[model samples]
Target: MSAIARSTEPRLDSVTCASPAGLHRMAYWEWGDPDNDRVLLCVHGLTRTGRDFDLLAQALQGDYRVVCPDVVGRGRSDWLIDPAGYVVPQYVADMVALIARLAPARLDWVGTSMGGLIGLGLAGAALVSPALRPSRGRWGLDATPDVPLGRMVFNDIGPALDLDGLSRIGSYVGQDIRFASFQQAVDYVHAVSQGFGPHDDAGWAALTEHVFHEQDGQWVKHYDLRIAQPFALQTPDATTAAEALLWRAWDHLPMPALVLRGAQSDILSAETAQQMVSRNANARCVEFLGVGHAPTLRSEDQIEAVRRFLLTA
Candidate 1:
């Protein structure tokens, strides 16, 4: 892979993450002086890559060491051999390995949408996976607490899902096509993310980067089309069954929590985010205006809020 400096200042690292299934090489962008003991691992969302954090990481570099991992199916990380393996349990396994390799001890976490769910699944003191403890397949680990996942930031997703909104996402989950130009990609992004609402030109441009890949002299999305397969399993019956288990895990989380919801999010309702706060004494929440489903932490206010949440209260 041709290595280019991830940022204008030219500081990045090509890191490798080894998991039992395979030696999955992950390209991570690291910032900060490298001597800082405080580490924050940032995880990106489904159909998105870790590069999503470039702006936020750049801003937080001086205060905390940041490591961003492109989840298995999305970016530099190797696609899983089995599409069935793309579920949360498998993701949790890869994360445990990553924490062991990068943060052997406690550390901070920042996640966006799907990444946030992964972090909450791991660090939530009471969070449990039915698959993990079932007699059948369980994260491929028969035991629990594989690693210490510290404080977490859950972006929008939660235990209960809005079926209508979820199905809305499924409408274009795996359409096979390509855009003619970068601006076309940007327009498509805005169209799909109507829920996110009112981003400036730069914010819109940054979001476009999340799904970028170059092919045949054109820029397209990087993820495999099959990622939509999981959404099929999100059948009404299955989501109802799965959501309860997630809530149970939340009920038992042993660490501090921060839940941020887009004010207009259809997925994680305002009611549920508040319930999460009520459950944990240390848990707090903030909603970004004119946003739905997620708050991309690109705005100065968004960045400052996260910094304050992590470093202070």
Candidate 2:
């Protein structure tokens, strides 16, 4: 189950997972001493790939082995034929498969948005999902057992949905439009993510590389547009159903959790973030004043917060 990946970063190895159906490859970045038993798994938000944690990974150094995966349909991973297949169930399954491949024995998780939801669903469901019941590669659902998830971090997302933001995002879903230039695409990304704080040219450039596409004479996005189908499908009656589906997953999460909210984020509203803090007793909460949707874990302040939590909590 070792995932195969190649990177310029030092002191880590890459591996790929053989997964279900059309899902073939899972690309991830690893850092720190491979023999170190402590592992940290960082999953990025939707529309983002695993490499987003490059800075956060570097800061942590040898404290723990950090493994970041590009969920199916994003980054170097394969796309699903059925857009609806991008649901949480499939994602949770992908993570389980990833854990099997890594075989860290015990691991902590840090997930943004969709990645957070997947972790929450796995930790809170108490094995509610049939796909997560296996222990040591064998079925053991209904038989309570120790889980691999240790410290969990959820960034700029909660059980509550920012309907307006959700709808606004849905408006552009499934459109396979390509930009004439990478600059244009990056500009669009910056405009859309303005709530996440002010980024200098270099910061924006790094973020741009994670998602933009430049092919021959054209520039486009790297991930499939179909990844938006679920959000698009949530309309009229489906919206309520969609909200309920998400709420259940968040409410049921049962592990040590930490939630990071961007101060200006419309997505993970302040009130909702408070509710998340209240909901999970053992869960610690923090807010980044100048950011929204998510706090870029690279900043010095963010690095300290994450490192403090990783080492002490």
Q: How high is the lDDT of residue 211 in model 2?
A: 78
Reference-based TM-score of each model? 0.84, 0.86
The local distance difference test score of each candidate is 0.70, 0.72
Name model 1 segments beyond 4 Å from true.
1-23, 124-149
**Candidate achieving the largest lDDT:** 2
- Give per-residue CA lDDT, model 1, range 1-313, as digits (tens): 1122223342545445445565665556566645455668888877777777777887777666678877877766677666776777667667766654453234678988778778766754224453232121122345344443456777787777778777777778687768888888888888898877788877788788658766898886777767888867777788777777777677776666678788999888989888888876767898888889777777787788887787774
Tell how far residue 106 is off in model 1, in angstroms.
3.0
Candidate 2 has its poorest 10 consecutive residues by lDDT at 1-10
Residue pairs clashing, model 2: 3-14, 3-15, 3-16, 4-15, 4-16, 124-252, 124-253, 124-254
TM-score quality measure for candidate 1: 0.84
Q: Where is model 2 more than 4 Å wrong at Cα? A: 1-22, 129-144, 236-252
